[model samples]
Target: MEIQNDSPVNPKQVTSAQERGNPADVAQSGDFNNSNSKKKKAPDTEGGTAKGTILSIKLAPATDLWTTLKNGSVKLRMEETCCGGVSPLTVTQMFQKTVDLCGDHVAIGFKQEKQWKTLTFAQYYAECRKAAKSFLKLGLERFHGVGILGFNSPEWLIANVGAIMAGGLAVGIYATNSPEACKYVALHCEANILVVENANQLKKILEVQNQLPHLKAIIQYKFALEVRQPNIYMWKAFMKIGEKIPESKLDEIIDSQVANQCCTLIYTSGTTGVPKAVMLSQDNLTWTANTAGKMVDIKPAAREKVVSFLPMSHIAAQMMDIWIPMKFGAATYFAEPDALKGSLVNTLREVRPTAFLGVPRVWEKIEEKMKETSAGSSALKRKIAIWAKDIGLKAGYNNMYGNTHVPCGFALANSLVFKKVRVLLGLDHCTKYFTGAAPITKDTLEFFLSLRIPIFELYGMSESTGPHTVSQKDFFRMTSCGKTMDGCKTKIDKPDELGSGEICFWGRNIFMGYLNMGEQTREAIDKAGWLHSGDLGKFDEDDFLYITGRIKELIITAGGENIAPVPIEDSVKSKLPIISNAMLIGDKRKFLSMLLTLKCYMDDETGAPLDALAPTSVVFCHKNECPATFVSEVLRKHDPAFYKAIQDGIDAVNSKATSNAQKIQKWVILEKDFSIIGGELGPTMKLRRGVVLKMYKDIIESFYVD
Candidate 1:
């Protein structure tokens, strides 16, 4: 695969080191090209290819790539396209091929009231074909968009597949999103039909039905609820109408799909305002699944049992729940959206899944629960736990992506200490555990590793479909997300002293562009074809990508220091139990401070009351005392390592910030957690910075006063 840099720019017009007044003359200083002149040949290993250890990989300075354009603009080659030998497959064809190859295999499983309902690969394909016929009957063929608004269920996947099968684009709206937000996505995507889960979702659609002029029909999955509207259609009735359609017609519809055709419109959970509809084509999804699979070592039979609980609307869930399993012919178990915790545990035990995907929040909950149960244990047990954790970390690092070379003492520790921890969490059978969506704390990651669960961290955006980089077992780095996946190039543009810069990527896996917003799309993807990820990241000498934060999310203090709040917040949250979400305020202010919301678990009868839980204040807390006190004491007794990490992070944040933006001078932890339903968080659980600032304007103002 080759990156085509065909942008018209004269070489003579390009800036030189002398013109920039740089004395180093870095690019022409030495015989850098001769560094790899003596390439040694190696004997072929498995699959007729040389297998050897990767010594090192590093990023050259930006000064090396920067050039002045004819238009007086500075241009640099951010990333080279890394396309592998895989061809793009349409969403419809992907499912059809899977069904053809594994007809009797279970394709999807979900709860329907009491018993779990399942669909075989062939049955799933047949239903999708019939649903496609129904969509065609509704005049939704060719370039049309279909919206799916519901929680995780068989119908949601059916609607998604059906839309694509009919040569239309699938657009997913978060079930928790407000009516206005839903309307925004529907209108933005120009969706003509919407498949809703039940009456509640239908009501949200109805509330803004008039606002969406293009929405012609609303199909509800459940038949029990009554929706007295001209546009409403029951899912069963809709499918029954297309039952008479011949299978040949479905084949024709499937064949009509092109590789570059739009498959889905995934709207990102924008932290600033309304979300943008990212236009992901068949090529994008196919390449993403293929590349991401290689990075995480997603093998065919090895990755069979996968327990999926994240929202299907999001890219992370979409990759694991829909794409990856289908590509590898793996069986996936869907967890009930309402009872995620119950379903997760039950599914883990019942399926004994080999692979699982989780966000940082879910893993943190598991860590918290584990520590809670083991707190104040015997000294022998404590020592055993420590010994087990050390061993597990070694094993975790070695076997992260696929490498497995456990140390002798660590192997013994794993058998003695970590084995029970894995059993307790139902992770004894899990071969691969992945964490994404948000930055995970190293301490939190290490805690899971100690439990014998290899938690591999990954990084990506909605535009990339799923994780672009994932930590390998042998080459794992807690601080970095991982190396770039096979067939994808990643680089930081205009890096600072810490090597942090706007992360840019180039590959077939990148989305086509934002739907309908041509101007914004052009701005996001430059003339050189690289996608500006808008995230600030850096690559280490080992090629691991360390994500700092969103470039737009940087907090520039009055002292002129630019702070990336994501890393700081992640460090703090990993240490503090009561805190759930935090937003670092004080941009252009004297000192840095934070507005935090308490974890919802603290309010439950099972856990002790939080000290900051004030029910009435603008910045409410559950109680009046410091919520960190109990958490600190608990950690001090059970895990001194974790306790010190938290203390160190707090001290660092205080010392690093200017006087005005220093460690939250007057902090108030909210009683309630920020959520999409509450208008505090986006659908993807990202804090809405503007909304938060407005909500706590007075409290923020108090910091400025005496």
Candidate 2:
């Protein structure tokens, strides 16, 4: 796909936020000359190819992230991109320009000590530079991985920029990973100098430091109770040492940076087993940042505002929170990590950001809250909501002449109903809201559409630099991952009779491949240059790609019919308001079954997390016990009303399935929810199927009578 340098940000008014929500607002400017590129066909419209888009890329450098080759090749060789016109500066140099333009502007905000705290762009830049100087003083080498372990924070941002600015690699570790998992990353990545948040992280690192052969110094951020150690240094003291470094040294490091070098290592969410560090180059990052902004019609220099609530350890968040802002001058606000469940909505309301990104879960929680709220409200409020929602659903599919646009009555509907909902949900200013990192149910997407809030679904993994495909702004297909992103070409390798195949991706967007694991890297990306994403997908006649399921995850039943579990599982979750996770379990079995976990059921009147889930909704027994016995014993203990509700939810899901092989035949509710700390979920909240299956092996086996 191709996009032109059509809508450049007005240099005269650099302060203006690109508030236009529609892509059509930015007219096509530069010529689309690439013969391979497809042209604009509506997202849902069949049989037409979108005219191919040709985008001019720029080279930016912020070298070496995590995981090193440590091989004979001192500098890794990779294919380059067609970067047109101006040669972009290193990431730090471009950031310096951004700092100059967005100086004194409120760049970041977060809650601290029960009050809101703010940081200006100028101040943020200064902190990053100071932190860089301190890293230099500590004798950090260029391209050395400076491991960072923390949630999203002002200090984390500063340290990341600072490390890269000082010509060192910035490596982020998931704050939720186990001590063993943490040790694996630190050692494999070859990090010596590490920065961590608070005492809990420090405690974890200290426990593993003896095992970490390369680790030497540790820098600690905020702590209510300080821990003293020989290698530990307070953040304030670290910055003070920066004053001793020569100012010219910092500038010299920036000048030496090159675009083709590695920038960061974004580890894949290893659902099957151990994660591999995917090494992304500076050009890979810069290209993604530049194209992402263009895809959503966000101006490169415009001061767009966005929420940074997702983990910085994840690639999507890295693009949105770090790279997007640095490339586009977008103001990013950090929501208190602990309070994101309760406080993010309020923060978003206050920020009223133009750009919003969320996983399906985040959107579902908010959507569920609205449903519960509407149920308890007065008659008139309920009627108005029902009426407004009808309008919204229509507006979502409303075609304005040739262009697909929101129904003309949406403004009226919004003023009457959706306006209040948007205000309450804190999305009044959200123009481009994206959902990815996981598949969203059709019901959840429809829920947002029924609310007249455009929540577009995109598809990508850390291997593909976050977004490989994105739904067009106004015209989008809820069931699809949308059109291919600019600079990306997709191929469905050996499709089945049903047209589903393993999604293979090519172009400049693919990563430089896995670090150290040569065999794995070669397996993932062919010498021909196509990165085989294990996802089973298909392109519509209109070229909109639809992700079906993962190739390895397809369940072949006893009847020999293959089934996709995600859709069935997603269906169950959407049908059941309280269910947080639903894993289908019928591999080599008679029929499909599921293991269920609720998201702490809500109180009917108060809309709060219910303390008791009708007392018997959960099955309780020994870990080794059979599921049938567990459920029987649990049922003997209390009223069956709760079980009936769960059964009804299961039935609802089964009704949506097209075939008997696809429908869930039986299920069991687990006593606990799948959690990251529990080793059932990755840091990105993706289910670790192997871990979950092993942990509940007994529960799964009991589904069949033996």
Candidate 3:
């Protein structure tokens, strides 16, 4: 895949060696050049020993070298057995073991047709076993792929787990995927069975089924569906056939599973080109859970509640909702896919969850809502809020990193201001919140931190199992992604004056390799064992990792200056409550420009009364107001502390940018937010850059015309 440069830098133009820093001189020099070519001695066999060679700084981007090292370790790690030297088991085995141990616990909760339903651990296990038995009964061979097409439902999880249990690799088809996209993955993986939730999902599969020669059967989880094809079977009827087998036989099949076995085939949501199917082994996932558990030191009994809403198909959600909770024996409350607005508030109130995970967009929305409420309060109430916020910020910062003991005057602020704010946001029951999957604005992070809500920023990708780094409650840098997780090695590939480069990871959690795409897999995981995370990042003096942006996403201006769009977009979006998505435009242009999409909170008719509810007489425009005005109002209400910061950002871009690249010199506000259903976002809620560019081609073109 070609890395598109929207900024100033021409990707084809490589940086000269003389401009780069020597790795030998840095304090983390050993970590930078830990390639196998140097023949360095392995570290002690003890768990904490740093056996791998330290990285050596190099001038060129170290993508190829890192991939080699990571591939080697992926093989080695999979070969190593866990659970006291029994035959090595894969991630699927670990999941099955947990279900076996806790069959009666609540495993999944969801709303089916507007009624809440739940699956006990035993029921969940039984369903998976049944599905697996059905697959095996249908003669599905080991390593064959099965595609699952559905929304968030218990059946989706059951089919996913069943695919692995049956010794077939499971591939997920995003519920929101187009028929063509689904066809691409099914054909690419050469899937044998397609498991779908309902007739609607089945239809999409049918559209592309003719193109897939390997497809042997289609299974529908829902009953009473009209399917004329002889190859299609109802989920209930298929399970009945599996039920004929003795229970002990199913248990035996599960026990015989091994760690190196292929389990999941996840496709990367790359911004450009066809997605690559990532092949992950059971060992890869289990090791990831183990390493992540050690890093966070999660207590099963203490912090048990998690509000799960992110798509399970995404690796981050799987880690947070499935693996982490399973390992910790924690309870997770699933939210309805359509009820995110009300379900979020209701779930928190009902479950009083202690931990939750969200993408930056979710938190940004929360911040916007809070500001909207605060916009028209009385003068006296505003004064009280400001005072309370100050006290809360001080105490919150201290409490976050373990400095909960409030000083004399600070105690007054918490009682008067901060405490109320927490109650207002319905976050009074939360201990901490994890934000990841995309870059979060510093202002948004600080605002929650100030409100005494512990927002711990984390970073990772599908290829890495899940999160590789998370900020410790008390020890966090505003600019950093957090320290590397335990059992993982991290370093920069090439250094500029800022000591930043492509972030490389060598750890037990890396995936086995991409599925079926040997050349691509080899390219991603080189001969060594280090995974080349394409993210550009830098380390501070304290070793905290700060992600700048995707190396491929960096924009080079016509002035020869490279600008990372992530930070800039994050900064702009954080301050603009009405804006949900913002893409930086103009590479090789004099300056940066942007295309901003407004987040639709409520319909104009539904929200117009809110403006009347406000004490101020500011007129409500018909969703056609200047984007800048809407953004300014949002910043003024939500983040009063960052007024100067927001102004500075706008001024900097305006002054340095050429007419084309200048600070969105002319822009339009999108009437709706980007969403998966809207075809503007991917399943993980990541903006589809190409889709957005195409959809808004006219608006973008208008900026340069006359």
Q: What is the TM-score of each candidate against the true structure?
A: 0.80, 0.83, 0.79
Between the candidate structures 1 and 3, which one is better when assessed by lDDT?
Answer: 1
Please report how far candidate 1 places residue 665 from its true position, in Å.
Answer: 4.4
**Sort order, TM-score high to low:** 2, 1, 3
Query: Which number leads on lDDT?
Result: 2
Candidate with the larger lDDT of 2 and 3? 2
**Model 3 vs truth, CA RMSD:** 9.8
lDDT of 1 by residue, 201-267 (tens): 8899999998888878889986565767766888888887677677788788776555554678788
RMSD of each: 10.2, 9.6, 9.8
Ten contiguous residues minimizing lDDT sum, candidate 1: 66-75
Return whichever of 1 and 2 wins on lDDT: 2
* Model 2 TM-score relative to the real fold: 0.83
**How far out, in Å, is residue 356 in model 2?**
0.9
After superposition, the stretches of candidate 1 with alpha carbons farther than 4 Å from their true spots are 1-83, 340-343, 376-383, 394-412, 600-649, 655-666
Which regions of candidate 2 are displaced past 4 Å?
1-89, 112-115, 399-412, 601-611, 614-652, 655-658
